[model samples]
Target: MHTAKILIAYDGSDNARRAVSYTAAMVGSGGNRLVDVAAIERPADRDLFADDAAWKAECARRIEAMRTSLNEARAMLVAAGVPEAAVTTRFVESCRSPLREAQECSIGTSIALEILRLAEEGGYDTVVVGRRGVSKQEEFLFGSVSTKIIHAAKGLAVWVVA
Candidate 1:
């Protein structure tokens, strides 16, 4: 039997938490399976008043907050019968795109690319993600990360939970 490699994209949001729960249910009853939980933190949009130090500090705080959510996701996965060692949690910084460039990309687009990169290199069979995340307003205006991932993650299966 082939062991399943699942990647769950997580952030501190209701949609992300639901993705975790869905992953736990899918893996809990299986044998020889593992799940990789990853969160890509977008940098704070720079401000006129906030200098480099302040921006870095803000990003640090955001990563720290994500750590708490990562812990909760790990705990939930373990409680659902996956071994602690089988759950791997990771964090990455979203790529910084230069401003006023024709090839510029949004943070969400960078994040989706990163997820696909990891999936291909790590040999993950399926990439599971939340359909929508914390910011309903942003999603309403710009669409969600899942949508971007769906379009970019080719030759792989993507399971998105609502």
Candidate 2:
């Protein structure tokens, strides 16, 4: 039997936590199923910090928080009857290549792009993200990740849990 690979984008938001619970219930404890919860840590703009040391400290702090959030998500899946072995967590530090920077400026934060890349590369059939809506002006200035993913996801199934 073919296993269903599910990829969940998590950011520790309340809606993100709900997405984790919903996915666990949807997938259940089936044998032929795998779930991956992924979180992205976008680097802080260097210009925002006073010095290089401060920037480095901020990055480290962000990474630590991401790890904590991933751990909590993992526990939630396990509690929901998903086997710990069948569930995995990924913490990705978003790439800062010049091309990627340009893409982020036009699209949403690089988090959405990174999640899409992970889903495609991991051969996941479904992508799940929590819906975090913003005002029209804010969306136009800085696009919402869920909206961008819905527009860009070609063949994969996407779930925008509110």
Candidate 3:
């Protein structure tokens, strides 16, 4: 049987690094697999400011930051023995307004939901994420996005790396 494709949710955390390491080990053993690293970018709140130019500039800066982080994660994955060709990266933007609208329209969509949707749509069989995100809040709560992905991703194994 072919190895399943793995989607690793990376946010430049130590746990994410562990996930990449684990994936590398699996792939090193001749596992037939494709690895995709995804980073979620939260959109800037337009309601917080009235200046359009400032919002645009902030958005651009955030995107660039996300890109840099993703690139670094990709490099780490490659260093861990995963072939560059076998790995892909994705950046998903999650805007609050769109989510609110979706909820109002009875869509009830979220970034976690979108991640699982993308995983399913792309035919990946497994999802990997860190125990915590970049925020590292110590409130003893699972990040909402990771928790949702864990519970809602039917037929797909979810791995939470510490």
In terms of lDDT, which candidate is strongest? 2
TM-score of each predicted structure versus truth:
0.81, 0.87, 0.76
* Candidate 3 residue lDDT tens string, 48-131: 768877776776787777778788777777787777888889876655423222222212256677778778888898998766
Q: What is the C-alpha lDDT of each candidate?
A: 0.80, 0.81, 0.72
Clash count list over all predictions: 0, 0, 0
Give the top-scoring candidate (TM-score): 2
lDDT of 1: 0.80
Give per-residue lDDT, candidate 1, residue 99.
21
Task: Give candidate 1 regions above 4 Å deviation.
Answer: 94-109, 133-140
lDDT of 2 by residue, 52-103 (tens): 7888777677767878989999998998889989999976655542223222
Which residue pairs clash within candidate 3? none
Q: Model 3, 78: alpha-carbon shift in Å?
A: 1.0
Q: After best superposition, candidate 1 residue 3: deviation in angstroms?
A: 1.3
User: 1 or 3: which has the higher TM-score?
Assistant: 1
Which 10-residue window of candidate 3 scores lowest in summed lDDT? 99-108
Worst 10 residues of 2 by lDDT: 97-106
lDDT of 1 by residue, 40-123 (tens): 767677673257777767766776798888999999999999999899998765555222232423355567777888899899
